[model samples]
Target: MDGRVPAALVEETGRWTFGVEPLPEAADTAARLRRVAGLVLALERPDPALDELLGALDRAERALSRRVPADPAPRVGPAADGDGRAYVDHSRHIGAFNACFPEYTIDVDGSRATGTVNFPVVYEGPPGLVHGGFLALFFDAAIQHHNCEVGEAGKTAGLELRYRRPTPLLTDLSFELTRTVEGTRIHSAGRLLSGDVVLCDARVDAARGQRSRLPAVSPRRVP
Candidate 1:
């Protein structure tokens, strides 16, 4: 297929609807926090002013820690919150802020998907290049995201990546993917590019299953 996203899919613009709505307040807070973390990573040297900021953050962390105990359940699947909705968390791809997750944006149409991402310094591994592990994680998220958008997704069975060139950090990069299905196996192939140069590529394999078929999350008890 051509490298361009089909005109049909381009016309269907908007965020994918497979996931439950993100909490607007939480999402905003996360975005702010992520920005701060990125800035901290970009710092050239220690600053005395950070001491006061760190102290305040410490207290805030302690206070917030008491409000929510950690739940070990996975966040993606059927009735993840016991609300009877099939939810797919796309926080890594779009919306919601996760300091550890590499941020990116994606657009999907039928069995093909495309997107752009800018790796921050925090994800750097080799000098100015992004960590190889993060690229693998990004591919997994993008492929699963495409699956969910097309209304068929499941657990990642396997993922393989080939690095052709070092992916630089703090620069805009683009990627494209095409998916094919065979029986219960879903196969997706993707390429990460800097202009016409392919920096890396991946093939992800997943098992096709219905959201209702996924194991249910145990309901949390009210205190």
Candidate 2:
């Protein structure tokens, strides 16, 4: 192969978390949640009970919100140090809501990281293929997680992706990131693969600085 890359061993480490299945108890819960999400999206015919189910779920959500109105942003594994909740790392992340969160595992090794995930039937687009937007999301997250490894966490400044082949759903997918540091900026490239096939490629540029707004300083009187 001209530019082919070999697959890395998927290891369980403290640096990895998010949608993991290490703890048997947590894994069981995550599996159930993922299955429920799949059923919610895979159905073609509308079920009469869906409305009632939604109402019940809504009530439960409201009750939970009342109990714990706010929670710290979920972190990824033990490497996470940020205080706020990370929407991307949350157990019930946006992707998880669509049934994609619980299907992946990330491995961090210094300035590099790799992830393996399988998209279910619910993430289908363009026939039996995964949607382009979702692929982008994975790439973005993979690179961001890589940036976290070098203690230079930041927001993505720019991202570019190329679709080499249609990513098939319900198949094992691999994502890899190779990050480089250039002073305050982090450059990363990621690839999505299915076995020997390259499905998508992405490059991301991230700046290391204030990820959020800086606290305002009192104005000093000047003559």
Candidate 3:
């Protein structure tokens, strides 16, 4: 909802706890990275000063890379604690600190939701328009966010989108979503809008399953 969770809703739903709280440090770093990414795309020509920045970034990358080895493990889903309770770290649902993911925020109100997003210049596809694929990705995340907040979420069975018009980049846009639950299936429909004009719309179908039924993550050995 727009405000905090209603007490009655929490009592009826048994306290919806799915996503973990985002660390402030990680959030700050992500905001900085996003700004840097935007500037990288906005540059008109290669500036000699960028070479210095690039060298510094390369050194930082190598320094960080040496500290950890790659592990192919699922970061999302049910992780068991010592007390035998499942805890899911869904911080990445809203992009987390991952620079590759599109960033947006949604507010859930019962079966309906609303949110706003501004596609950065880095996400541009055509001349001054946001990529169609990114719009689809944003809709999927927004709908799933709405479903999870309402206490009913599942794996996406299917997703369909319709591009009514080209969505512009670097402009504030809003969206709305409505969800319906039918037995073990959840249907969510959403639309991206620029003021009153609809630029894109999406429908997502997900198959609901118990958290216990989710497969446990096993890290893969790297050679």
Which stretches in model 2 have alpha-carbon errors above 4 Å? 1-33, 44-52, 68-103, 210-223
How big is the RMSD of model 2?
12.3
Model 3, residue 16: what's the lDDT?
33
TM-score of each: 0.78, 0.64, 0.78
TM-score of candidate 3 against the unseen true structure: 0.78
Per-residue error at 82 for model 3, in Å?
16
Candidate 3 lDDT tens digits, 1-223: 3222221122264333443344567667767777787787788999877798799889988997665434323333343211222122352255655555678878778989888898887788999999999888888877877776776677899999999999999899999999998998999999999999999989999998565554443232233
The candidates, ranked best first by TM-score, are: 3, 1, 2
Regions more than 4 Å wrong, model 1: 1-20, 70-95, 217-223
lDDT for each residue of candidate 1 in 1-223, tens digit (9 for 90 to 100):
4221111221154322333344556667766777777788778899876787799899989997676545433433333444232233452355344456666788888889899988877778999999999999888888887887776777799999999999999899999999999999999999999999999999999987754444433223345
TM-score of 1: 0.78
Ranking by lDDT: 1, 3, 2
* Clashing residue pairs for model 3: 1-108
Candidate 1 vs candidate 3: the TM-score winner is 3
Q: Give the alpha carbon lDDT tens digit for every residue of 1-223 in model 2.
A: 3221111112344232223223344455656666666787877888977787789889978896765315454433331333333323322123433335435677778877788988776666798888888887777766765665444556689999999999998887888888888998888988888887888999999886542232221111122
